[model samples]
Target: MSAPAYSRPAPESNQGVLLARRLLPPVLREWVERLGGELATVCGYQLGLCDDRGKPTGGVGGKLLRPAFTLLCGAATGARPADVVPAGAAIELLHNASLIHDDIMDGDRERRHRPTVWARFGEATAILAGDALIALGFEVLAAQRHAATARSVEVLAKTLRLLARGQELDLRFESEARVSVDECLTMMTGKTGVLLGCACRLGAAHSGAPAEWAVRFERFGVHLGVAFQLADDLLGIWGDPAVTGKPVGADLLARKKSAPVAAALSAGTTGSARIAALYARPGQLTGAEVDQLTELIEEAGGRDWTIAEADRQVSAAWDLIDGLDLDGPARSSLATLTGTLLNRDH
Candidate 1:
């Protein structure tokens, strides 16, 4: 979800990292910090950049993946990646804004292995900061010199509505003990996929891509977004805490009813029963209970099911690319980025 992880070239795939860094230049940090600081100052707050400790950490850039997609999609449509900087910046700011609010709502204290905005700054400051970023996202878009600014703004606005609706459904689902797989998928698409779709659509629109071309890119994003969230769900349970910046079995403790958890609940197996019973209780699950819940969910085919689903989604997204008029480099970069995202351990 974050492209900052690839901000610099990695040893394994320098080219991939180069591609990412090119899309998001080194100057990105300066602008991001300036905007964040300025916005907070205007509102009588002193929230620094997402990574700013007392000293400058420059921190985790928070995986600018969505904006990278915006840049790449524009390149596919014959627009230069550098030319899409405004759109990319807007998307990236909006994403971090969402992350700030999401952490508050989820009561999460950490992100990218660091303390969250609300955890460092007060809840009030975090909330206002998020609002400021959302407004800033629009301002960035409005100043975009590209011909496609109008269409991009329209899509971004619609995506915001979809994102809000998805968040609402997610909150509603948390209270319910059982949710269908379809419902979970819908929620995931709204929360994750829609924004990614916006990134792609906005980029292509800026490049003056045909409407149908933009639509195809959007669909590509839907598949990729679904896969991304599914993988994230798996990470919530089994990922190494050191790598994930989340405690192991984090979702189990929260009883989030993630796609994998939802699948396990419906498996009708004994393992499923145990998982359901654990979730039904009012108390927070203990560490041992979290381990047991995870094992049971895996036994119920939740883990394997989610892996297969993610793979399927990636394959579908790739298939959509075949229908697009992607150039050689853009197509290759897209493929490379997809593989990088899906194979990420963290």
Candidate 2:
């Protein structure tokens, strides 16, 4: 299973993911890795043996940005990172659940430069694994016995529903003759924003941070989520396959409406009609067709609009960050994480 290397943003070590990485409450990383054991015992095992002497097939999955956020939030609220371990695990598990389900639905065979769970196992097994993750996420959070467990459950449930609604809109857009910019934006919000909000807000919630502060974190997450998704959509269209692990113009090939293409279609420019004509042609697209579609999306202002919109969302996120009474380490780490995400090439 020599898949390509995954190139998403990730903290590299216990020094806090990526060098120049100074670790705060360095023990935070231990708990983060422990989460892999928990997940592997479930979904990871069902797939195959672990890496390097049976280390769990799904060891320390992904960039772990969400759980890190949860831990940082706990630290900011004056709790030891260990105190919020359950919250961290729950957030990450839920996020992974979403990713697995998304890959299955999107027919993505590879992730993290390896076969997706559905591809390795079977679709039914993968679906069950995703469901198990979701339920396990709730169980871990509930076991924490935090005063906010109920609230967290409610938020997570709602976020999952929003994600489903967004996915529905995404599928519908693929077939519809037209989709509005507002509709597309709304879908992005549902698909990407709320879970991030939950991650940030939970940081405080797990530690009984005030409702006011929790709300602020939620706002910050909203801004961050929108920017994050837009950046992802940008990568989907223009990012390198060698780096991003998907073919060039993967989104265009799927003919699914992502931000740039949607913006292009709605721009009412000559490029808009051109894009529509190309999409309507159907069948499989050639490399030349993919290249021309990329050209049309840019001509219709889709690329610029998406970049600007992502920037706008980032600015809004910073505004929220500035208003928080976060401690020094948390603030610095947050700023670093935000920059890393914005700067990611794939």
Clashes of each: 7, 4
Best by lDDT: 1
- For candidate 2, what is the total of clashing residue pairs? 4
lDDT of 2 by residue, 164-190 (tens): 887888777767977887888888887
Write one digit per residue (lDDT tens) for candidate 1, span 96-121: 77878888898988765557778877
List candidate 1 segments past 4 Å from native: 1-60, 344-346
lDDT of 2 at 180: 82
Q: Estimate every model's Cα lDDT from 0 to 1.
A: 0.74, 0.72
Global CA lDDT of candidate 2, please? 0.72
RMSD of each: 4.9, 5.4
Name the TM-score of candidate 1.
Answer: 0.85
Q: Which one wins on TM-score?
A: 1
